[model samples]
Target chain A: DTAVSQTPKYLVTQMGNDKSIKCEQNLGHDTMYWYKQDSKKFLKIMFSYNNKELIINETVPNRFSPKSPDKAHLNLHINSLELGDSAVYFCASRKRFQETQYFGPGTRLLVL
Target chain B: DQQVKQNSPSLSVQEGRISILNCDYTNSMFDYFLWYKKYPAEGPTFLISISSIKDKNEDGRFTVFLNKSAKHLSLHIVPSQPGDSAVYFCAASAIGANSKLTFGKGITLSVRP
Candidate 1:
């Protein structure tokens, strides 16, 4: 079984459009994270949630928001996407005290 | 500021040979380091890791070495197979950082038979 999964594997939208990516984990993990891999192939963490509570909010723009409906799901919502928003968004999850994180197949976003 | 850095962008190795990937970090507070491998169109998968207290870790043909003083680390794959070709990422996390990892630019490894 896929421990972590993401929906909308590919998203292509125009500038000023909004988009959302969904993530789900079945590893019974309590912590979920959202990361972005830019054109330079640098993967950076944007937000982290533990038990549906926001724990880490990096220096990301307010246009990007992450919502966790429950411990098993975390979704990212982007408002007024720009060309810079075109990159691969990855969702990861891990146990509260564990160090290893399981990642899902990334969702590639292209904002023209 | 790139906390973690993989200076090399790519590495090519012949099958049945040892492939070494190097990484360095600038943050002294980092205590945990990990290596992840990713294929095209997929997310990275955990490979090996080492803690600051230890100098080396080994699992099968994959081993990771850590040097706390130099803030350097390396991953060695012995007898690299063609299937081992992928992009390798080096990541580090500091204590009390809520498991937030700082990743390097990643090195693409190509194993040719």
Candidate 2:
């Protein structure tokens, strides 16, 4: 069984268009995270949620918002997407107080 | 500024050989370090990790070494097979930092038969 999964593996949209990526985990983990890998291949964390509570919010812009409906799901929504938003987004999850994280197949996003 | 750094962008190794991937961190508060492996179009998977209190950790053919004073760490894969080729990432986190992980630019390893 897949422990972590993401939907819409590929997304191509124009500038100013809004988009959302969904993530779900079945590892019984309480923490979920969103990460972005830019063209430079630098992977950076965007947001983290623990038991549906916001825990870590990086220096990301307000245009990006993460919502967790439950402990098993976390979704990312982008408002007025820009060209800089073109990158691969990954979803990860882990147990509380655990350092190791399990990631899902990334969603490749292209904002023209 | 990047807290974790993987200076090498790629590495090549022959089958049954030893592969070494190195990583460095600037933050002194980082007490936990981990290595993750990723393939194209796939998310990273956990490989190995080491804590500040220990110098090394091993699992099967993969081993991770940590040097607290230098803030440096390395992953060693012995008898590396062709299937072991992938991009390797090094990550670090502080105990009280809300489990935030600082990742380095990954190094792509090519294991040849």
Candidate 3:
């Protein structure tokens, strides 16, 4: 079974539209996180959830929402997207110790 | 505003030679450092890591060294192989809060056989 998986491998949307990228992990990890990688390849953490509850919500705009329905699933929803939103979004899972983060295939979102 | 930085955008090394990838961090608060390798169209995979308390950590041919006072860390891959070609990223996480990591811009390493 796949340890971590994310849907919509590619997404292209117009500005001001809403879209979502879903992620699921069967590793039974308690922690889930969302990371954004810009064109320059710098990675920044956007959000983190533990057991369906939000834990680390960075300074991201309210348009970016992370919803964890259960311990195994975490999804990202974006609203009123902008051109700057064109980047690769990755979903990751890790244990409490933060020992290692297992990442899933990223979703490339392009807002025009 | 970038906390972690990898100056070299790319490097080429012959097989069986040593590959040294350097990384620097501006934040002294970063206590844990890690190295991750990524292939094209794939997520990064953890290669190695070192804590502030330990200056060096080694796993097989990969050795990670940290300089606390200098806030610099490097990953050395002895006898680099062609299969080792990929983009390597340096990451740092602060102590006490497991608060996610800050990654560098990444350096592409090409190992020629």
Candidate 4:
């Protein structure tokens, strides 16, 4: 069983299209997060949810939205996806604030 | 702006030697520092961390050292193994930020067998 998992590990879509990346965690954590790793290998946190409530929202584009239906799941939906959005998106979970975050295998998105 | 920086993009070490990865942060607001190891297709795995309150924390062969005065931290792996070959990312965040980690550019560590 995967402690943290994401679906469609590989994603290929055209620019301006809409796509979603699904994530789930079984660690019984209180917080979940979404991070984007760019081509230069820079990882940046996009959003974090605590107990199904939005907690941290970095200055990411409005096109990137994070929806957490429950404590264990956080899904990312990108609208009007741009070529610059081509990167590996990672999902993670944490027990609480400032705790270690367990990450998923990542979804590699390629925008053509 | 990149608050966390990993100046070295890559490092090579011989098996059984010690591997040291350095990180620096411009923002003193960062109260915690962590190092993560990532393989090809998988996400990063937590390697070690050090809180701002402490200077050092050890786990098995890995040890994290933090120097708050210098705004610097490092991950030291003793007797580096081939399996440890991966990209290592240095991340940091404030305690109240709910784990909003700002990660470095990452350093690819290659342990030569």
* lDDT of every model, 2 decimals: 0.95, 0.95, 0.91, 0.92
Q: Is candidate 2 or candidate 4 better by TM-score?
A: 2
Per residue, candidate 3 scores C-alpha lDDT tens digits across B1-113 of: 98999999999999999999999999988888999999988888889999999999999999999988888999999989999999999998885434688899999999999
Q: Residue A75 error for model 2, in Å?
A: 0.5
State every prediction's TM-score relative to the real structure: 0.98, 0.98, 0.95, 0.96
Which 10 consecutive positions of candidate 2 chain A have the poorest summed lDDT? A93-102
DockQ of 4: 0.76
Name the runs in model 3 displaced over 4 angstroms: none
Candidate 4 C-alpha lDDT tens digits along A1-112: 8899999899999999999999999999989999998988788889999999998898999999899999989999999999999999999998885568889999999999
| Candidate 1 chain B: worst-modelled 10 consecutive residues by lDDT | B93-102
Docking class of 1: medium
How big is the positional error of residue B70 in model 4, measured in Å on the Cα after superposition?
0.7
Best of the two (1, 3) by lDDT: 1
Question: In candidate 1, what are the lDDT values of residues B16-92, reduced to their tens digit?
Answer: 99999999999998898999999999999999989899999999999999988898999999989999999999999
lDDT value for model 1: 0.95
The digit string of per-residue lDDT tens for model 2 on B18-75 reads 9999999999999999999999999999999888999999999999999999999999
lDDT of 3 at B96: 47
In Å, residue A94's CA in model 1 sits off its true spot by 0.9
Q: Pick the candidate with the highest DockQ.
A: 2
